[model samples]
Target: MDLTVIWAFIIAFAVFAYVVMDGFDLGIGILFPTFAAGRERDRAMNSIAPVWDGNETWLVLGGGGLFAAFPLAYAVILPATYPLIIAMLLGLVFRGVAFEYRWRDPAHQKFWDMAFTGGSFVAALAQGMTLGALLQGIEVEGRAYAGSWWDWLTPYTLLTGLGTVAGYALLGSTWLIWKLDGEEQAHARKLAIRWGAATIVLMGAVSLYNISLNADYAARWLTAPEIYWVAPVPILTGIVAISMLRAILKERNSKPFWLGIALFFLGMSGLGVTIWPYAVPEALTIWDAAAPERSQIFMLVGVALTLPLIIGYTAWAYWVFRGKVADEGYH
Candidate 1:
């Protein structure tokens, strides 16, 4: 494979990793209100507290990878999705502030907690909408957006927004299942069961809608000889979904979260496989979008050193925070 292709794969994997990692924390934030009591909520928060900041590092690396490997795609998509980007950034700020503020004032903590959860909800939703809009493809004339604000707010985009929320909720609930015990674990399992069911339904609907609107994707994925093997991708996704269902029903202590990871990875695989050549779907091919080769080579050397450092630090943080949140709680 070409170096450009290798770099593209690197960027895509970094993004997918971010989605799988930080994605759950965002989901946890969105589900914060569902936990009822303050102690349980605090434990839930503590479960992710150590790694949440580190999780966002992947997002930065993903964007940096895009700038280095696919500068053109980055420039165009970022500007087109500026409004949604602002919303996500504001949500990030709100979440960070809530994280800090909620711990400081026992009296006003609830407000901060709610702000964190709501901020997470907004961020996740905006990102989903941005993805949906991107899937619909930008009206790009040369290198500029040729559409209005309303174009970014369509029914399909709305469906995607909800679907992403559901996906994150599933991830969050499963994380709780893994990290908590006793009543906390039970509550998370219940949430996981409900959210998992809801996610499957919502995502199934989105898939059907995508197919109905653009049968071409199905045709490309199902009919083309070169892509005929791709059918197994969805088949595997269904198997993972079914496995999740069985795990949730059985209420396994140690396996549900792993199953959730499987589900997320399978879904991501379906997406990455289907959109292999296109960085922005039909709008821009990876080669067309890539920065200059010299730039990629230069950046790769820096990235090689930095990425491992980030990973090491993140692993250390998780290690330090390992084990269940204690009874004494967030202090």
Candidate 2:
């Protein structure tokens, strides 16, 4: 079997896990200001307090796996989007700090609240823009990133960034609906309906804009053979969107969050379809950018031993913390 393909899937799984796990918390942070202060804010924060930090483990795994198993891809992609990467890291740092300090420093809670919202917004935007930059294609000349520093900043990237923000907000609102009770849950349901509609609109916009960015992308989704495989993605996405809205409007607590997750899954699957086999999108195939086979084999063994443990503990944490959150508890 090809170890490169295995490692590629492993890294993709890690990234998908990171986005699914962390996206909601960042969404909560984005919706923080809209939530009422005091008990409402505390309940929102508490809903994620138990699992938020653990969610980042997938990010570390994804990044480290790329560096170890596909060092060439890492080297090329990083320089091409350094500004977005830096902003994302800084935003994560500030968000983490605020997450920890907001409760301890009540006197400065307002400041920390702003910091949390700003950090989450910045991080989510940078992530989406980075994705847009990659989708639009990077300039690679002789195994090096050849693009200008600001190449990542474009109208398409901005749309993608905003779309991601809306997507995350939808996730956050659904999460709140699942985790809060009474007034908070009702408020969250309302937010979920609005954000859900906005997210679907923006998702469509981003997909169309992505197609416009490259004829290859257009062909991938529109041409005969490829279109046959890709056609189900949007259809499924539409189905999920309808189901999710119905759940929200009906005031079902848990279904909206799980359905939101399905939407993200379908979106990522579409992305994989769009850029499969290519590590740098029209620049380098995964094989061309992979590390030595010996290195991947070595790392696969380590991952095999440790990944189960990570999954085991993460699942256990969620199981232990299951159910609605109260303002006075869990934080």
Candidate 3:
């Protein structure tokens, strides 16, 4: 196999890992407001506390992969989406501080918790904006950004931003159902049901809008017979989402969280498949943007050795932090 093809798969897998791992934590942060107080909110936070930092590793790997494998795409995307990137970084900072600070200052815990929620909302929004902007397609000339700054601030992009929030909130609520028990668990279930419904609506609207705007949707999604196999993912996602709603109503939290994750990942898979061969939507083909084969081969050698180590450490960390959080003071 060609090194370019191998690197392409690596990059794709890295991005997917980031989306699946950090996704739920982001969602849990977004879910902060609903639980309100006592064991419920704490349980929600505790559910992710064990692996939150490790989950973010995928982001680092994904970004690094892009910079190393598709330098041109990185150059264009970073500058064009600088504002959103800044917002995301800032949100992460606030979120990080909130996690520790909120626990330390028992006197003002509420404010810090709110800060965490707000930070999550901002980060999720920035990511969604970036995604929407990518879907809208940027102006690329000789591997550079040629579009105006205002081009990224469109209404459609804004809608995508909100969609991200809805999605994350849905993930968070589902997570709470899985890890928490008693009254907290029940509240989380309720929140999940409400937000899950809202997410389905928003996601559907975005899909319709994107299809309407992009004339190539038919070619990508509905053109050849191969698309028949692809169509079932979204259909299955809808079915699982409906089942999650029923599970929540029945006060079944654990399974709903995993199912919610499956639904979320299904949506992501649809987007990835729909935009295959194009790293930046319609802007650039993966082949055109891939790094040299020699460099990719070298990178592959490193990934082969390092990937297992990272995965092992991640599993260990989660195992150490497993089980519901007690009333013990936050360290």
After superposition on all C-alphas, the RMSD of every candidate to the true structure, in Å, is: 1.6, 0.9, 1.8
Task: Please give the ranking of all candidate structures by lDDT, highest first, separated by commas.
Answer: 2, 1, 3
Q: Count the clashes in each prediction.
A: 0, 0, 2
What does candidate 1's lDDT look like per residue over 21-61, in tens digits? 87788899999988875778888888887788889888888
Q: What is the lDDT of residue 290 in candidate 2?
A: 97
| lDDT for 165 (candidate 3) | 87
Q: By TM-score, who's the top model here?
A: 2
**Runs off by more than 4 Å, candidate 2:** none
lDDT of 1: 0.81
For model 2, what is the error of residue 87's alpha carbon versus the real structure, in angstroms, after optimal superposition? 0.7
User: For model 3, what is the error of residue 217's alpha carbon versus the real structure, in angstroms, after optimal superposition?
Assistant: 1.9
Report the C-alpha lDDT of model 3 over 1-331, residue by residue, as the tens digit: 8776677777777777776677778888888776668666766777787788788888888889889988878888888899999999899888989988877887999999888988888999999999889888888987788988767888889989998888888887777677667777777777787888988888888887777768776566666686687888878988988888888787774778777777777877777776777877778888788888778888889999988998899889977876665655345
